[model samples]
Target: MREYLADISRETEVWTADVPTHMIHFNGDRFLGPHS
Candidate 1:
């Protein structure tokens, strides 16, 4: 369970770093249906 949690945390970190560039390149707001 601890290892699994660690993996999830690592993935979240990577996603945080990558999401903005992905959103800019792919127009993520359109797919996400607008932030409120």
Candidate 2:
């Protein structure tokens, strides 16, 4: 869980422009895949 959250935080930092709203969703979708 910590690793996942850390990765998410790192990804969010890299894509700070559209953080929570856009990039987070895209990142989650990309990492977790369609089924998740």
User: Which candidate should be chosen as best, given lDDT against the real structure?
Assistant: 2
User: With candidate 2 superimposed using the best TM-score fit, by how many Å does residue 12's alpha carbon deviate from the native?
Assistant: 8.6
Candidate 2 stretches greater than 4 Å from native: 1-26, 34-36
Write down the TM-score for model 1: 0.21
The C-alpha stretches of model 1 lying farther than 4 A from their native spots are 1-25, 34-36
lDDT (0 to 1) per candidate: 0.37, 0.44
In candidate 2, which residue pairs clash? none
lDDT of 1 by residue, 1-36 (tens): 323344453323222234444322233454556666
What TM-score would each prediction reach against the true structure? 0.21, 0.19
Tell me how candidate 2 scores on lDDT. 0.44
- List, residue by residue over 1-36, the lDDT tens digit for candidate 2: 333465564445332333444433435445556764
